[model samples]
Target: PWLPLEDDRVRRLVEARGPKEWPKLAVAFNETLDEKDQRTSKHIRDRWTNHLDPNVNRDPFTVAEIEIIRGAQRRMPNEWTKIAALLPGRTDTQVTNFWTNTIKKLARRALK
Candidate 1:
């Protein structure tokens, strides 16, 4: 995780140079930070793509999305990444967390 300042810098860098330049951006970005706080290019890229990108939708999941997730889980079972691919602007972590925190709890209650 990054401090707000670091995250701001990353967003600025991506806006200026775009996401494809992550390796080069990571090198430049890391030079401004202490060694203990350095992040890999892939890590930075994943963070930007999955969480920090302006395009990510942070809205509550819709009913259709919930049904899609339920269906996807029935077919894929634990395939969070694959399920996430079916929903635009969503990440594997988000999908897994929703299932673990919400849908799974509901299913367990139904069985009881």
Candidate 2:
């Protein structure tokens, strides 16, 4: 459920009121998209903080990036922001989801 935070309407609302108004903005944005409002303020804030930057590209992780994430997981556990910082160009949500869905599944399979 990715929001295009860069959308003009969404961006304007966010710029006008900041992250605190995300719930209202989400509804408005969803309405414009003709989509249901399934996102919460936290979801909007996370996208705004991590993925909304025009300079950042959303690319899949490389093997090296995965290894870095593994090491960071051992050191920082569930500290997603710290783990994301270790992997340049990645976001906390991306790192966290990767760990939860990919790494954890691999670990579980290996344990069997």
Q: Give the alpha carbon lDDT tens digit for every residue of 28-110 in model 1.
A: 88997799899899888988977798877778889999999999999989999999999998888888888898967888899
Give me the overall lDDT of model 2: 0.72
Instruction: Put down candidate 2 lDDT per residue, 1-112, tens digits, no spaces.
Output: 5535444555676778775766787776566454454555666676676656454547778989989998888988999988888876777878888888996788899999
TM-score of each: 0.77, 0.58
Q: In model 1, where do residues sit more than 4 Å from their true spots?
A: 107-112
What overall lDDT goes with each candidate model? 0.88, 0.72
What's the count of clashing pairs in each model shown?
A: 0, 0
| Residue pair clashes in candidate 1 | none
Task: Find the candidate with the highest lDDT and give its number.
Answer: 1
